[model samples]
Target: MGSTYRLQLRNQAKPTDPKHQPYRFESVLKVLNNGDEKLKSWKVFVGFRNDEYLVSASNAVLADGTSLPANVGNGTVFAGYPMTDLKTAIETAGDLNQIQVQVKLLGTQFGVKPPNVPLPETIQLANDVHLS
Candidate 1:
């Protein structure tokens, strides 16, 4: 069995006060088991970046749901950051479209065996997200 994963920017909390410089946002990461075999556990590494530098990076895990045998299931993880930093990064790079997100799946599942099996590797969720 194999799995599919995705990452996205969600749950945006903009500052109510215009004077507030830093806006806050969250990254929603999801993993979906698409094959017949049930997943034992999974982990992913995510990085948020702009053209010039990385804004934030995090590792997420799914151990509870994957403990049982099941098919066609999904898991989620969230990462958050301040908009002021992100905006500054983008501005310094001179392009709003330079914002991007990257994700990589760690090949070791908790209960899965056999080293020869292939595992999902990497995915890019967004090259540019329109921040309003």
Candidate 2:
């Protein structure tokens, strides 16, 4: 199935001395399928260019499905947890509810300050022809 990837980063809290410590930020990774068929065991690769640490995440697991904490700075692949398949927007009777995977992530990034956005280097569906 054809799909598009979106990454949104936001730092709403104002903390003191962020440069000295990890700057807290929120990130959402979304993949919207616009193809005719649903993708089973889909995987999305998130690339990071900075030293970022992921504190927590939801509705996602490491591509290998083992690591307790998903790392960002080092770059990692995220796979849907439990809900392994990404159904088409129309497959769910146009509800569009299942389309949302709720890939909200909380993390701390070091070495980035004001005027700079903590965005991933690249976001894409890394799964090719192979299902594994």
List model 2 lDDT by residue over 1-132, tens digit each: 433333365453445565554577777777666556777777787887677777777888887655655456878888888677778777787455565465777777776765777677777777785434
State the lDDT at 44 in candidate 2: 82
Local accuracy of candidate 1 as per-residue lDDT tens digits, 1-132: 122444232222334333332222223344333323322323332232211111333333222333212221132222222111122232345333222222332221222222332222433222123112
**Candidate 1 root-mean-square deviation in Å:** 20.1
In each prediction, how many residue pairs overlap at the backbone (N, C-alpha, C within less than 3 A)? Answer: 1, 0
- lDDT for model 1: 0.27
Q: Alpha-carbon error at 20 in model 1, in Å?
A: 14
State the local distance difference test value for candidate 2: 0.69
How close to the true structure is residue 101 of candidate 2, measured as C-alpha lDDT?
Answer: 62
As a whole number from 0 to 100, the lDDT of residue 24 in candidate 2 is: 74
Model 2 lDDT at residue 119: 76
